[model samples]
Target: MKKAILVAIGFILYGAAMWYYLMHGAQADLPVQFRGSAADPTMFMNDRQLKLSYDFSRIKDWIYFLSVPLEWLIYLLVLGFGISKKMRSTVKEVTRFSVIHTALYVLLLSFLSWILTFPLRYYSYTISRDYHISVQPFKGWMKDSLIDFWVGWIFTVLTVLVIYFFIRKSKKKWWLYAWLISIPFTIFMYFIQPVVIDPLYNKFYPLKDQVLKEKILTLAERADIPASNVYEVNMSEKTNSLNAYVNGIGSNLRIVLWDTTLDKLNDKQVLFVMAHEMGHYVMKHLYQNLIGAIILSFFGLFLGSRIYSWAISKWGKRWGIKGLSDIAGLPVLLLIFSLLSFVAGPVENAVSRKAEKDADRYAIEMTKNPDSAVGAFQQLTISGLSEVNPPKLVKFFLYGHPTMLERITFLDSYKHKYEPKELEKAKKQQR
Candidate 1:
């Protein structure tokens, strides 16, 4: 109990330090032209919008920081109170089959965690709705939540079965074996996500605007991406935010734009957005991200295995865990991995931000329409109510892409640098 208290206090202090940094740190400085001032009313958000964005961002950040500590505490409570042990015993009494016992135990554990964390999820939903960002109906939201719960359970059970299988077979080298199997498993999930999983929540179909579709295809052709179609998903029902992305591998690869994007931006702006998505493919960002994730998982799993062993050696009996192979010890593994993920988030986000910045540059060069690129980013900010320049710590931790201010400034610089050269070349050709 004292250990748990100490752990909780440590996490709370960490979260507090992060919050303080976000509130007090200097934000990104924009050029005078792009700054939100009386003279440049159209450049960025106005005073009221800025305030709202700041407030919304703060609330969201608080929820995010609080969630990790709360999750850790919940897992601690479950272990400390022997809830996981009770769950395992109950499942074992009902099934003699090992697989069935593991599945049942995982199901109960997932359900309990889901129920415990539901208030946070619902509060997040409410905040989105209240801010007019989410338009999903309550029933639809609950249905999606239930779907997530079940889908998560299915994967959790599979993973636990695989991990325990190796643990039973080779106690010393199970982590290595598990990591090996995970490589293909991770690839399989990525491959099937667009085809098998994504459609469960939202409908997707080929882009309906033939003219716009042709334009996007032209950009894809310019980038030498083997895309046969541009897909549009029905996202307006879920949120007012705008997004476009490239997902899947090989035949399942898709360039997807939210319907909200079409509703919000003009044709040229949409093309620029499409160009950005195509840049991900052109730059091989998907494969790069996949490799990075696998590498991170390798290190994370290695460290987690060591930590899990140490933890069990010290506290297994107290927590009713029999050994490292025991299914009841799953929460310890989860708790360890979660801590690793939290610690590694800033590094991960920084890498992602760099990739996004590269993609933005690719988009601008491909389209050669700085105005449209700037306008697309502006519309994104307006529609999403994004903060143009978030605090340094907030951007480091939460932003996976450059802030609107950075993107717009980049475009402005790109125009100044390249437009003159293009103009001179055109004049020489005329002569």
Candidate 2:
């Protein structure tokens, strides 16, 4: 009994220490930067200033060169860790071991990304082409690739260096800086991105249809969201998949729609989906999300600081990662993110699920066409092969929203509630 009590106490202390480290130590090191916005030429990506052009082949090369090793390393670690279960290690022992292993992996990855960022210019572009998703030429591709690499490198190095210094000066407050950095970084990335990043990936055409523009503005007014602008991004230039997102904030706001979404779905379905996106805007989910992210990232970094920093400095020499930009170390970082993902994953999913459920409710109420909403839900299910059944714990830990089955079930219940009135009303209205 005493031993069990001690174990419980130890875990409690560890949790508090983890919280303290993350909340106070590492927040300022990472910040939210990229986001979607209407009218912003860079709505889709930081293509222009970042120098992105569609060239999936080049992206494939970069990933092949840089991200692949990390991907494989993570795969192996998962397998190794699972296999070690037969050794019957206690959870605490595993936790400590995993923490060390994950931290070293993350350190290596950070250094590798710094090194391979230049190649990222070509990297993302190639991904576009190789996937048959790109409509960009090589010249545009090369230019964009370089921009992506350099800008990405600058932003990354600056933020990382800042956090590293803070970690050095005050291990206890590393998480505070992590939270603080997200505010400025999110704003800068949001505004400059229209100019710096998106032009390289796809063309931005102003909403040419005055009538459609007027309708969108009207919709925004009805939704109580201001009309920053509206745009039809040439997503067809890159891919035919449909999507829509309400981008930017305040003056930077806009309803950016992909042509594919326009082409595929009818107006009602589009409005239903747009309403969901608008739900995010009205709820200010993005900002809330930023805050949450800042908090979580700090947690991750605080837990990881000593482990990763030590590992990087020590093993860095062996892998030829003399600088933070060493491309070879990316896998290590991924391994860390993969490992720490267990905790943050649940927190993130909880927030997202709340937001998503709220939006689903809003869409149902606004459209007043629960049937259409149901159809849309079906579309999502079949389109994705989303599992209908998942363990409750899995939903808690991994799911960002209620399972699709639950969503469908809710809508079905809704349908049953008004079936008689709905049927009679439909018949009367038709007459």
Candidate 3:
């Protein structure tokens, strides 16, 4: 009874703290730059051009309310209290319990999404099928689906074990342990991912067009990046988004260009697109972003350990689950991370804004065709159906990109900044 009262009090205090944080901001009085704004256009060579004055507070509120029931379902799943009536007490049983739950959750989510592909198939059919995105048929989709489920299971199961081990090892400071362990693993993922991991999703075939290949080669030379594999991915099996990316590290690094992008973008546009991804590559945004995540998660994990570790123990049985053993701990971590992540939303946005800014500047330097990049960004935003003008609060909490209008305004400012030098460089190149 006493413990229940304490847990209830803890919830109230956490709510109060979160409320105050949102109302005042973690640091509301800081300047726009320090506060993080996507309003600066020079931030990205091609940034999403969203309008700046629109507000979606009501919509966001509605979404927040909608999250409740779904969260409750997920909460139940994580705690092993939903579908299964059995509970585990031992560490090994807890680990198995966590893995089983994660697997089913992943499979369920994937299966449901795959089942929904009928409507999406027709809706996005033109994206790849019309453009020769892939020659794969329904069989291909099934194979890909199975592969995805297996891969997702591997990833989720491993992650669960890691989280469990960290919680066990750290005992008192599992949050700190989670951060330390995950950082290196996440960083290593940067190197191993594109080479060893991504091929599991789809087959990679070298772009066979000599003209296109030569253009890519020349661009690579000009960009001072090593000439390497340019592979086409089978995005045609589903979806219609044109995309390109640089993946892996060192000699393992390769470029995977979507057939859709190749179909839609001219060599110049493709170059601009590749350069943008290259910016992320050279800037090492992946690892840096992961580092930021780990840091924030550490705070979240610490708070979770302090608060829910006890509640989970006391009330875990009510839900037909074990105590703070790994299985039941899963839901607690999920809830804690979700809640605290949203609580620390501003800080995460700040990090993303910084990384994006760097990537933008890097893209400009790599492509030196700021005009094309700007156009590409506008089209990208349009294709993606992103809002141009989000509410100030929405932008503060959610937007990683400076609103599209802010982007254009910044670019307008930037074009003038580089006019003299770009003209000089163009003349020199002509010589």
Candidate 4:
């Protein structure tokens, strides 16, 4: 217990220090031209917008910092107090069947976790609404929250059953087996998420504007992609933010645009955004990411199994856990996995950032319209209230793409590279 308390304190301090650094660190030195003076009012945000952006960022950063340590502490408390064991016992009294007992315990655990963490979720929703980022109604938010709860409960039950089954069957090799199972499970989820899960939240249909759809399809053809359709989702009903993405794999694959994106961007800018999504598809980033995730999970599960064994050997009796096969050990497993994920976040973000940067470059090269590419990012920043430049550590940990400043600068540099050649050609023609 003393060690748990010490570890929690350490995490709390670490989060606090990060929060402080982000809030107080030297701001990224964006060029004056990109900073958008009040008189010029260029693509960059003005002073007032920057102030609001920073204020929103601070709130979000605080929640992120608080949530990590709070979640870790909650898991620790659950394990240290044998709350999971108690819950498992309660479920066993209600159901004699092992599968049923596992499902009920997981349902109860999921509910309790939701109830405990709901305040943060609610605050996050309210803050987004307050900032004019989320337009979702309170009832709609609650309905979505419930859907998330049940969906999560179902998945957790299935995962727990699998883990415990392997634990009882092959105590030593269970981690390896689980990791192998996860590869197919992950792919299955990826394949189905676009067709099955996403529709539950938002309505989607083929792009309504034929001209724009044709243009996007032409752009895809230029990039040598065999896309048959461009889809648009009714996202304006939920949020004012803008986004576009490529999702799924194989036949379920899709290129989707948020309605807000179509409403805000012109045809050229929209084409640039679509080109960016195509970049992901053309570069096979999805497959790359899936392979990377599988590799990481393999190591994560192996290391977690080892640590879990060491921990059970030390405190299994105190925690009321019999062995690895015991469902009561779920919290211990969760605690270890959570710590591992937190430690791995920076590496994961770095890889994602690199992919995103490559995609951005592809977008410019494919479109041959650096101006529109710049415009697309500018509009995204304005609509999303994105920080043009975040602190380095914050970017390293949190950002999965280049900052707005970095993107715009790159576009500007690309534009300049061609402008000199164009000017020289015009001069020769005039002569």
Candidate 5:
């Protein structure tokens, strides 16, 4: 009774802290760079351009909001009702090798999850199609989904094996060991994702437009990004929405622009967007995030191990798992991890929003073209049919980047401290 009361108090405090954080912000004050009037011409959007009637967006939002809890419930029901245990037993009966059994069990759960979530996935795709965001045919989408399923399955199997190995060896300290091992594994995955995993989904080729290519390369050079070549992905084959990003590290590091972006944005706007992506690289946001992830995972894993142990003690027999090392206990591990991830989401997003804001500032400072910066954001807002202002709770939990309106207003507020080079030259001649 006492323990339960303490737990409840902890939750109350957590909720209070989150509310205060949302109302105020992670920082003492929002930086001058992010505060500004939305009335500037550079941030303009006419009513005709705005999709104020929120039929599709509302539906999408509800679907998203419901999906998280629904998925959590599914995980709980599967584990709580002994379905995961039965499946694991069957896998073990079929395979003599424990590794094979674990692999099969993880694959089974992955496929089952894919099947269960198919309806929601299809609905989202349908809505995206209706909104003219997604252009891929159903068959193409299905193919991509299958590929994603296998990729996720392979990774899950490997992760589960490593986790169980630690569970067996370290017992009480398994989570700590797992977290230590995961840092390097996580970095390796980040290093390879752009080079290996991405190519499986889309074709990336060097920017074909020599002029645009040169402009991007020049911007990269200005940002002091080494030997940075601009690569364009065939994003139009899948979606109409525009995007560009910098991903990976070392040999895999590169700037990637969506073909849809090239199709929609003018050269100047594209340059500004590329500059923003370059800002992430130049600022080493990825490295910073990697370090943050490592730190967060330590706490997450530590907490998760305690929760998993408590859960096993309460329902070990009913769930058919002897202990944490039991292969049948995969669902329990997943449940604990999922819950932790959901809880930690707001913190992660806070960090991400700060990084994105800094990147936005960097882009504006480097380009000295507030108009192009604001225009790019305006275009993105229209293309994505984004809400100009989201509810505080929604934004706190979901938004990794500031809203488009916020970004546009920030750019509109930019003030130069000095005259332009051309103006300076003319003034010198007159003198």
Candidate 6:
């Protein structure tokens, strides 16, 4: 009877999630506004700017598209074939202790999942290399991949143990307790990732060019960002793409630039990029996202609890899951989370796009260099093979940052100080 009540609550929460998003998160569908003449020659990219010969092949696009569904399919297979239960039993036989069995299952499940998913991963890398986006040698990439696998394994063990503990202790309210715990865990992971986890793959050092570093430090200071030193990572060894980011919290905080970005972008472009990254910190986007995640996790976990109960009720006997506490149900939990994430993409992207837009505006205002912002985005477009105008579906579902065209157009429309009369005139012109 209690299970039935939970299931009904899940359905209610799911409906509420949908309605909440419709009321609050559906603003992303609003039409884009263009100022100035549509026929303005500067609005379109020239041949060199567009990189006419760039090999952003349709095959690569299809591969990316297909891989999304393929990933969900793989997750489904983990549960559908009874592999999750069989592996759980095997680990149980090896160790009768719940804690040891959970640890063993985490390792076994990670290894099996990695093995099953490696082909798609290899193909994805092959495509990146084929398109000249990745410059890392296969052996080097594989070594990094191995490191990444073990790192993921460690985290999985920690998470699965906590979750099962909650399930065993409070079967009905575990989701609530787990969600509460995850808030701090998420923040800790974010805070530590730049310092601890990221260094495992790429080497980082202080920016070598003292002049450039000072310039970046000056910009950071001007932005009131607490970062004193600038760091550069050996990203050229991995990819030809350009990027810079401000990461970590408190003493661990610093601005990191990719060596590739330094090699390719001029000083002004690099400054603008740094400023954009600093904008994120100044705007407190990290804290905002954390708060948002905590809120959403409440709804998501509640809904997931309902779905989980229903799934286990239908498949529990066949899959050998005794209840939520059963180790065999790990895959089911993972699948539920994955599905919820997939469904929540648009709402998440809407929030991300707003943050990115705010950062762009802050960077422009701080640097007082609209042209540099435009040039920086153009460079990103060419180097990253970013689609300037993606399909509507892709834009709505997948895009976290606005398209290069939209960003450049915004820069083009920048006005330092438009009088009320001029603003009215501009609005008329746009109409």
Q: Write the per-residue lDDT of candidate 5 for residues 1-431, one digit (tens) a residue.
A: 46446654764565556545434443322344444455222235556444431344555665666567556656766776688889988998896998999999988888888888898899999988888878999999999999999999998988898889888898899898889899999999899999899999999999999899998898888888885578999989999788999999888897899998998899989998998888999999989988988999999999999999998889888878877788878778788888899999998898899899999999988887776777788778767766666656667778999866578777777744222654687899999
Number of backbone clashes in candidate 4: 0
Q: What is the lDDT of residue 150 in candidate 1?
A: 89
Which stretches of model 3 miss by more than 4 angstroms? 1-69, 76-148, 165-170, 173-180, 209-227, 320-322, 392-398, 417-431
Better of 3 and 6 by lDDT: 6
What residue pairs clash in candidate 6, if any at all?
Answer: none
lDDT by residue (tens digit), candidate 6, 201-223: 88999999999999999988888
lDDT at residue 391 of model 6 (Cα atoms) = 53
Per-residue lDDT for 161-181 in model 2, tens only?
A: 565455556655764775577
| TM-score: model 6 vs. ground truth | 0.84
What is the C-alpha local distance difference test score of candidate 2?
Answer: 0.56
lDDT to native, each model: 0.86, 0.56, 0.60, 0.84, 0.80, 0.77
What TM-score number comes out for model 2? 0.59
Models 1 onward score TM values of 0.92, 0.59, 0.66, 0.92, 0.87, 0.84
Model 3 clash tally, residue pairs:
7
Considering lDDT, where higher is better, how would the candidates rank from best to worst? 1, 4, 5, 6, 3, 2
Note the residue pairs that clash in candidate 3: 38-402, 49-404, 50-388, 50-404, 51-388, 51-389, 52-389
Q: What are the runs in model 5 whose C-alpha is more than 4 Å off?
A: 1-49, 415-431
Candidate 6 contains a number of clashing pairs equal to 0
True-vs-predicted CA distance for residue 79, candidate 2, Å: 21
Candidate number that wins on lDDT, 2 or 3: 3
Provide backbone clash counts, one per model: 0, 57, 7, 0, 0, 0
